[model samples]
Each structure stands twice: as structure tokens, then as C-alpha cells.
Target: MILVTGATGSIGRPLVRRLRRDGTAVRALVRDEAKGRALGCEFVVGDFDDPASIVAALAGVDRLLLNGAGALPADGEQPMVRQQKTIIDAALDAGVERVVKVSVWHAAEGGRLAEGAHWEIERHLKASGLSWSILQPNGFMQNFITGQGSFTADGNLVGAYGDGAVSYIDCADIAACAATLLTGPPRDGETFLLSGPQALTHTQIAEKLSAALGRTVHYVSLTADDMAAALISQGLAPRFADDVAVLTQGLASGIAAPTTTAVRDLTGRAPRTFDEFLAAHHEALAALAWAPSR
Candidate 1:
């Protein structure tokens, strides 16, 4: 049996569905009973902070998908480091055969936010003596719809990316890759960098959004300092805001513009393009309250 953490999240939701569709035995670890039931699969109420619940969820599970929330402003060190490390240790003790982890692209030592946190967890997972594969995905296309730190209060897309393009992959494709790794032969000690089929600038992204939503959605490019100040004004911690600005500013150099074939090589199909992603989520896009940038 496979146990999926963060089953209600962008990747986990599709992963669980794909596994179930293929008639694989899967269990979801959820924090809420209602959410668990909504998944329509075997689920156990569990929280990363609650070790006993996690232990209970691991029973009879051979494969594990390790994923959870990202860094928060209130965090001193990313909580995911402690939480995921605990799960790795427990999964080892539970006799789990393999684990698949979701990590961010550009994860390295001393990096900011999710990058640094994921690096720490990746090290822990590797040393646990358990078979593992890590998926280092670039930006998610879902961010445009969910506003994952990409939109202002008035729904304008705001960043310090200048004119650099990012090869943002769809979360569904990430889920498909995870499903393949979990259900197929173990890919121990391998890390895959996943991306969309093409790179796109924020200006191009805004154009796509305008066509899809039938309204002009603007991309506001600001300098690192101005972006940090805007985040501070929005009540984010100055340190956290500054880190975000620095990270986004790094994108201006086209660091994340590269695309990868890992998605196709794993799933035997090409990753979705930005236009495809926008079309698939048209209803969600229509529901968003984006206004024209002033």
C-alpha cells in the first residue's frame, strides 16, 4: 500500500486520483476527517506535528509520498525540516520500502525559504537508508490561479522577475511523475528536475490570462528593493520580504528559464504548456477577481 501525505494539495490530489484510477492500493494522510472523506480513498487523520498519528498512518504502507506546507513568515527555521525528517525516521522504522519527495528547484545549501529547507530534508531522506526519488519541480502553473505569493491585493501579478521567463510546470504533471515513481520500479537516490515544455515571461503570461479570462491581467515588475517594500507594507516580516525579493530578483538573470524532458521521459508524454494549463483551469480563472493594473 502507498500512503500519500498532503493528499489534498495541488500535487497530492491528482496523484491520489491517478493511483486509484489505476486500481492501486492508496491511503491518504489528512488532518481533517471531512477532507479525508472528500478524497474518496482510504485515509487516516494525521498531522506532521503529531508523530503518533503519522505512525498510525504508516501501518501496512510500503511506499510513502512526503510532501507538506512550505515556509511561513512566523517560522524561524522552516518547520518542514523537522516535520519531514521525523517522517523519514518513522518511515524507516515502519519498514517502508520507498519514498518520493517533492522538493523545489534551485534547492541548495544556504538558499532562502523553500530551497534551503528542502535541501535539509533531502539530505535526511537520503541518509535514512530508505529507497527514495526526489522531484525538484520549477514554479507551478497553479500559482496564477491560487495567487501563491504572485498576486497583489487587487489581483495584479507582481514580482521582481524583470523580463526573465520561467518554465513553470503543471502540478498535474508533477503528480503523474510521482505516480509513476511510486507504482513502478524504485528510483533510489535519483533527483529529477521537472519543468513545462516552454518558457514564458510574466508579460506573456498576463497576455494569456487576459485572453482566457476575457479581462486584462497586468504583470507589475518591480526592483528587488521595491518588491521587498511592497511585501513589508502588506504585513510580511521585513526579513522574509527581503529574502523573497532577493530570490525573485535572481530570476531576472534567466536562471529558471530552462525546460526539462524529465516529465516526458517519466510519463511518456509531454508536459502541459501554459496555454494548456490556462484552458484546463478556465473555470477557476474565470472565478478569480483580477482587476486591470493601474
Candidate 2:
């Protein structure tokens, strides 16, 4: 049986749905039973924070998809890394055949916080002696709609990216890639850098959003301090907001502005464009308003 963790998240949710549609037997590990039941998969109650629960969740599983829920803190307990080690340990102990993991682009080269954690996880996975594939996808297009990259205000797109370009693949494309790797032949110790068809800057993204929504939207650049303050005002922890500002600074330096063929190479088609993502999520964008009460 195939096991998926973080099954209710952006990629995992769609991954589970696609797997079910493909008639694959799937088991989902969730911290909440209610959410697990809603996924329409064989459900197990577990949290990566609890290694015993994670071990219990892996029973009878031959293949595993390792996905973490959020970015790891720069200095802390490193919950994501700990959880990944726990899962890999359990997988090795259980003799699971293949493991597919979601990592960040340039994780092996490593400087970003997420990249560092992924690098460590990749090292552990490789040493586990199991067939494995690491999917290192670039920035996600869904981040734009989810308030991580940009937000709408009177039909305007506001973000900290300025004019820096990024190849943002849709989360569904990431899922399709993951499903292919999980269900296909065992690719031992392979890494894939998934990206969209083309690289786009914030201005280009705004234009696409404008065209897709049939409204005039412009991209407004914000200073890192300003962005951090805004995010803090929106209820993100001050330290986390500062880290986000740092990440945006890294993006602005052009580190994240590159295109890759891994998505198309694996999926047999080009990844979804920003316009495609805008068309699909236009309504949700239109309905969102910056309510400080949220």
C-alpha cells in the first residue's frame, strides 16, 4: 500500500485525489480523524511530532510519500527534520521499498532554511538503503493566491518580489509529478527540479492576473521591512515574518528566477502557466479582502 503524509495540505490533498482516481490503494496519515475521513482514503491518526504515532501509521505500507506541513524555523527544535528522520527510521525498520519526498529546489546546494532541512533529510534517505526520489520544486503558484507572494487590493497585486522573476509551478503539477514517481519504477537516489513552463516576474504575474480576472491589476513592490510589518499585522509571528522577509530578499537577489524541464520531463507535458492558475483560482482571489480581524 502507498502511504501519504500531510495528506490535507496543498499538494497532498490533490495527490491523494489523483491517486484514488488512478485506482491506487492509498492510506493517509492525518492528525485529525475528521480531515482524514474527508479525504476518502484509508485513514490513520498520527502526527509527525509524535514518532510513535508516525511508526504506527506506517504499518503494512510498502511505499511512502514524505511531505512536511510548513517551513522550519531557523533556530529551534527543527521539528521538520526530526519528523523526517523519524519517518525514514521507521521506513528502514519496516523495510519499505520506495520513498518519494517533497523537497525545495537547490536543497542539496543549500542556504535557505527549508533547503537545509531538505538536504539533511535527503542525506538520511539516501543512507536508508531504500529506493528514493527527491522532488525539488521551485516556488509554488498557489503561494500567490495564498497571500505568501501577492495579494489583491482594489484589483491590484501587492507583494515584496518587486521585478524579480520566478518559475512558479502549480501545486497540482507537483502532485502529478509525485504520483508518477511513487507509482512508477524505483528510481534510486534521484532528484528532480520541477518548475513552470516559463519564468515570470511580479509585474508579469499581475498582468496575467489582470487579464484572467478581466480587471485592471498592478504589481506594487514593498520593502522587506514593510512586508514583514504587514505580515506581522496579519498575525504571523514577528520572527516568522522576519524570516519570510529574508526569504523574499533572497528571491529578489534572483536566486529563484530559473526555469527547468523536470516537470515536463516527468509528466509528459508543460507545467501550468500563471494564467492557468489565475483562471482556476480567480474567484477565490476576488473574494479575499485584507481584513485585519482575520
Highest TM-score model number: 1
Strongest candidate by lDDT:
1
lDDT of each: 0.89, 0.81
Candidate 2 stretches greater than 4 Å from native: 72-77, 108-110, 152-155, 289-294
lDDT: worst 10-residue window of model 2: 285-294
Worst lDDT window (10 residues) for model 1?
A: 285-294
lDDT of 1 by residue, 62-135 (tens): 99999997646454455788899999999999999999999999999878868988999999899899999999
TM-score on alpha carbons, each prediction: 0.95, 0.91
Give me the overall lDDT of model 2. 0.81
- Candidate 2 residue lDDT tens string, 1-294: 999998998899999999999999999999899999999999899888888888888889999999975553434345777889889999888878899999888785455457777888889888888889999999888776565435633546666776788888899999999999999877778899888888888888878877776777788788889887876765666666776777776787677888988888887888998888877887776565232132
lDDT of 1 at 157: 79
